[model samples]
Target: MAKIVVALGGNALGKSPEEQLELVKSTSKSLVALIQKGHEVVISHGNGPQVGSINLGLNFAADHEQGPSFPFAECGAMSQAYIGYHLQQSLQNELHDLGIDKPVVTLVTQTLVDKEDEAFANPTKPIGLFYDKETADKVSEEKNYTFVEDSGRGYRRVVPSPQPIEIIEQTSIETLINAGNLVISGGGGGIPVYKDNNGDLHGVDAVIDKDKSSALLAANLKSEQLIILTAVDYIYINFGKDNQEVLTEVAVDEMKKYIDEDQFAKGSMLPKVEASLQFIENNPEGKVIITSLEKLDDALEGKVGTVIKK
Candidate 1:
């Protein structure tokens, strides 16, 4: 059996409960196919839109009502649990329907980050939604949040995006994987936190890229393959124009060259590509697959998806 780490995209689980439920049902259909093929899977996922909405709603409530504002990490934890719940329940039912008795568990993972990480010096990672310059400035002043112009598309709040240094629950995850269990963990990039000098853990007000975190977990677990699900069926060069080209299989060296040329957008496909390259570099024999969720089965069969190797 192949050990694969699948990273679910942010939009896969919508903000609303009804919408998320439907999306999970559709996505689990393909994911179950892999389990049926005797592959043990550990899934990681992004919670951008969901957590953004949660934080926004909380901030709004705190402003109008007498409610207290929740910290960003707490909001991220909320997203991880609910999103993991939807995925776990949906995948469990799908597995049972397929007569696969493998139990699925959800872990609220805490990924370790460096307190002195350079990313903390410059918070360029955008979170939540975009607002007009005036509104953004007002919110930044009122809430003491950081604001930056995102690609000249008005202004948005940017936060530190720390790199994952370690997975605090990695031992438990490894045990579950060894026991023949399917696990869903590291949601929202595992609630970015850091250890103090005394070895105490505390949450930070930053978000870690889920794709990057997935690569870190895959490497830690020594998974044979990493699958990153996104909106595109294939990774493209010269995206969004008549000169767009689809890539089949790429090596690490060639990918680095493209990255050097700035072929991918910073907030979108670039992080995913970099994450794939990191996984390929760390696991020399392992492969990374980038494709849409609908074509996962075909991708696994070598019929589709952009596969990157070392």
Candidate 2:
């Protein structure tokens, strides 16, 4: 049996409570298939929209009712627990229906970051909602939040996006996986944080890319493959134009060339590609499967998605 780390993209869950649960019902079918095939799977997911919405609501409530604003780490923890709950419940039910008895649980995970990481000095990751220029300026002054114009889609509050250095609970995660338990942890990049000189852990106000963190976990776990599910079934060149072309398989050397050409969007595809590179570099015999959720099985079968290898 193969050990696989499946890094789910944003659709692992949805934005709303009810909608997210419903979506998981559909996703669970595919996940169950992987388990039935005897693959030891660990799950990590993205929380860009969900965490942003939670942070926005917390700020709005605090603004009107005098309640304290939710801290960034708290928002991330919320996303992890709830999203994991939905996934755990859905997957467990599907397993039961398949006559497979296995326990699935969600663990609130933490990722260690350097306190002096340079990204903290300049926050550039867009989060929360987009707002008009005038409203953005007002929020910047009143709330003291950084706002950056995102293409033509108004402005959003950008936070420091730090690199995930370590998974604090990796041992527990590995133990669970080794026992054939499906573990879901590292939600929203494992709640970015740092340790002080006194050894006390403190949460930082930053977002870590989920795919990047997943790659780190995959490397540490020494998994044979890192499967990243996104919106597209395959990586593309000149995306959205008439000249667009799909990439079926890309060697490490060739991926560097495309990266230099700026083929991937920085806000999205670029990080995914970069993460894939890191995983392949560490595990030379391992490979990365980048594809959409619907085509996961095909990607595994080498019939679809872009395979990145060293």
TM-score of each: 0.91, 0.92
Worst 10 residues of 2 by lDDT: 8-17
Clashing pairs for model 1 are none
lDDT for model 1, on a 0 to 1 scale?
Answer: 0.86
When summed lDDT is taken over every stretch of 10 residues in candidate 1, the lowest stretch is 149-158
Candidate 1, 120-211: lDDT as tens digits: 88886666666899999899888898887654456767777788889899999999988877899999888988888899999988788899
Tens digits of per-residue lDDT for model 2 on 1-310?
Answer: 7778898876435557898788777778888898889888899998776788889898899989868899889999998987888899999999999999899989899999887889899886667666899999998999798888764457878888888999999999988887878899899888998999898899988888889999999999989989998777999988878999999988998989999999876666888999999998889999999998778778778899999989
Q: When superposed on Cα atoms, how far off is each prediction in RMSD?
A: 2.4, 2.1
Model 2 reaches what TM-score against the true structure? 0.92
Best by TM-score: 2
Stretches of candidate 2 exceeding 4 Å from the true structure: 130-144, 147-156
**lDDT at residue 52 of model 2 (Cα atoms):** 83
